[model samples]
Target: MKKTITFAMLHFGVAFTITYLLTGSWVLGGAVALIEPAVNTVVFYFHEKAWKRAESKQLPLAA
Candidate 1:
């Protein structure tokens, strides 16, 4: 949960900052900020799944 929130905030800040710098529009910045979290969530879900698969494959088997 905490990881999710942190990742979302990080993505949101980056997206908002970039959008604001390029367009100088608060409305667009706000929209990008809103969209960032949803995008991060989707990305994180796949990332976590991939990590889990990798970890499981590396686990030692019982004798």
Candidate 2:
């Protein structure tokens, strides 16, 4: 729980900083602040699924 919250804050801080830097509008920055995390969360879900599929296809190495 603590790790999740820490990463959430870290992600938000970095996303907000870059968005504000590029747009110079707090409204736009805030909108991105909300949207980027949601988009990434969905993308990460699919990415992990793909990684699992790839891992399943790999053969075991010799000892």
Candidate 3:
């Protein structure tokens, strides 16, 4: 989706900015911009699965 692509770009910018600020190396900044998001994507997938599992285990309250 178009939105998803831009969202990835935004994350890249953030990662690049932070890494650049800390290390002052373009190569490191680029590396983190790609690697960090890749790692986060995997972590986020698992995190979402855990959240869904927790939500499913909750009982509904009586009205």
TM-scores for the candidates: 0.74, 0.67, 0.72
Better of 1 and 2 by TM-score: 1
Q: Which run of 10 residues does model 3 get worst, by summed lDDT?
A: 1-10
Off by over 4 Å in 2: 1-8, 60-63
For all candidates in order, the CA lDDT equals 0.86, 0.77, 0.84
RMSD of each: 3.1, 3.0, 2.6
| Candidate with the larger TM-score of 2 and 3 | 3
Q: Which clashing pairs does model 1 show? A: none
Q: How far off is model 3, as Cα RMSD?
A: 2.6
lDDT of 1 by residue, 1-63 (tens): 678778887888888899999999999998988887777788897899899899988968799
Which candidate comes out best when scored by lDDT? Answer: 1
Residue 12, candidate 1: alpha-carbon lDDT: 87
Query: Pairing residues by index, what is the TM-score of model 2?
Result: 0.67
The lowest-lDDT stretch of 10 consecutive residues in candidate 2 is 1-10
Count the clashes in each prediction. 0, 0, 0
- For model 3, how does the per-residue alpha-carbon lDDT over 1-54 read when each residue is reduced to its tens digit? 454456667888999999999999999999999999867766766777889899
